[model samples]
Target: MTDPSPTNFAAPWEAQVFALVVSLREAGLFTWSEWADRLGRQIRPADGPERTADYGAWLTTLEAILAERGVAGPESVAARTEAFLRAAEATPHGQPIRLENDPLYRP
Candidate 1:
């Protein structure tokens, strides 16, 4: 039987994150049940805002799981995020951003 869940993404990054999660799961990084449990907690924290279909939460959960699994620690993730931001800032309009574009890029 075919699944009927909505597959629409509001942004390209959302689709990318979704694909990353699926790839990681397929690679045995984590199970769907574990992902769902963590994602549920992230989406419905007692003091947090109620969220539904929040791709941002998916990203956050992915990061957390990766860190928990020693796949990529927070420091590395933060550094990469900074590098991407710098690269984006250095990129000219209508140009694709690349990490090599970052002023501090080495090699």
Candidate 2:
């Protein structure tokens, strides 16, 4: 299997989520179907205001899934969330840098 270190992931959130998923899978807390069902239920909105996707809602869903699987406790989830937010802040916005001077590219 590939290394599970955070540095192996291109994105911090991906690493965090991957860790949670792996932990859950190893623990055998729930089958894949049950995990999907729980996540789907969390993503869905109850009757009231217009339903929409939001960052908080997405994080909540992830947290709920992790909790259901017993992969992460509240403190761990909070720490991961903080790290995710920090990574988001550090990441660049807009188009990626173009390496036009590289020999691999001929334009």
Worst 10 residues of 2 by lDDT: 95-104
* lDDT string, candidate 2, 15-104, tens digits: 676676667667886677775565566667586554344344445766776666576878876765565555555556663334332334
Model 2 clash pairs are none
Q: Which runs of model 2 end up more than 4 angstroms from their true locations?
A: 1-10, 47-59, 65-107
CA lDDT scores, all candidates in order: 0.92, 0.59
Using lDDT as the measure, the top candidate is: 1
Q: What pairs collide in candidate 1?
A: none
